[model samples]
Target: MGDKIVIDARGSSCPGPIVELAKAYRNSKVGDTLELWATDAGVRADVQAWAQKTKNQIDSITEQEGKIVVVIKILNR
Candidate 1:
């Protein structure tokens, strides 16, 4: 396991959340967990597709208050 990183993209729209995710992923290591917080509704699907494309694992996707919380387990594969 590595570290837990939180990328906040609250109030951001469309590709903003996904973009932040990719940038973090580029510097992340396998076994690391990334917790992303976003306010964009599109993030739910965007993150899912990104995880699938990158072969990473999504630990959880939940809604808190008005934000979407996504936990991604890095695979680096």
Candidate 2:
């Protein structure tokens, strides 16, 4: 595990969180973890699907106080 890169997408709508996560992933190295904070409910499924499509590893998806926290690890890149 490496230092986590945090992306705060809170208050952002659909595609915003995923876009930020994608950007972070592109700049990250293998084994690096990304923590995305989003307020949009749809981001949960979006992130999951994006991770699968990109072959990245999702460590967890947690929700607290209407906020979503997605943990993803860079596996291929």
Candidate 3:
């Protein structure tokens, strides 16, 4: 929560948001939180699935101002 990476994916399509998140996460450290803001409805499920595949932890997901915000905690080595 304190140390995090925030990605804005508004107006992006299906895998676009997810792809951006993956790219951002690639350079992140263990235990760091990744906050993704997207307009794509698929982002919620996609991000969650991506986190599972990468062994990351999802803290919460919120919808505000027509945008979906996903908070993820990196748990990989």
> Which model scores highest in lDDT?
1
Using alpha carbons, what is the TM-score of model 1? 0.93
> For candidate 3, lDDT tens digit of each residue in 1-77?
43678899889885679889988887888878889989988888887788788888999999998999998988884
Clashing pairs in 1: none
Instruction: Tell me the alpha-carbon RMSD of every candidate.
Output: 1.2, 1.4, 1.8
lDDT ranking from best to worst? Answer: 1, 2, 3
Q: Give each model's whole-structure lDDT.
A: 0.91, 0.87, 0.85
lDDT for each residue of candidate 1 in 21-67, tens digit (9 for 90 to 100):
98999999998999999998899899889999999999999997998
Tens-digit lDDT string for candidate 2 (41-74):
8888898898889899999999999989999888
Candidate with more favorable, higher TM-score: 1 or 3: 1
Off by over 4 Å in 2: none
Count of backbone collisions in candidate 1: 0
lDDT of candidate model 2 versus the reference: 0.87
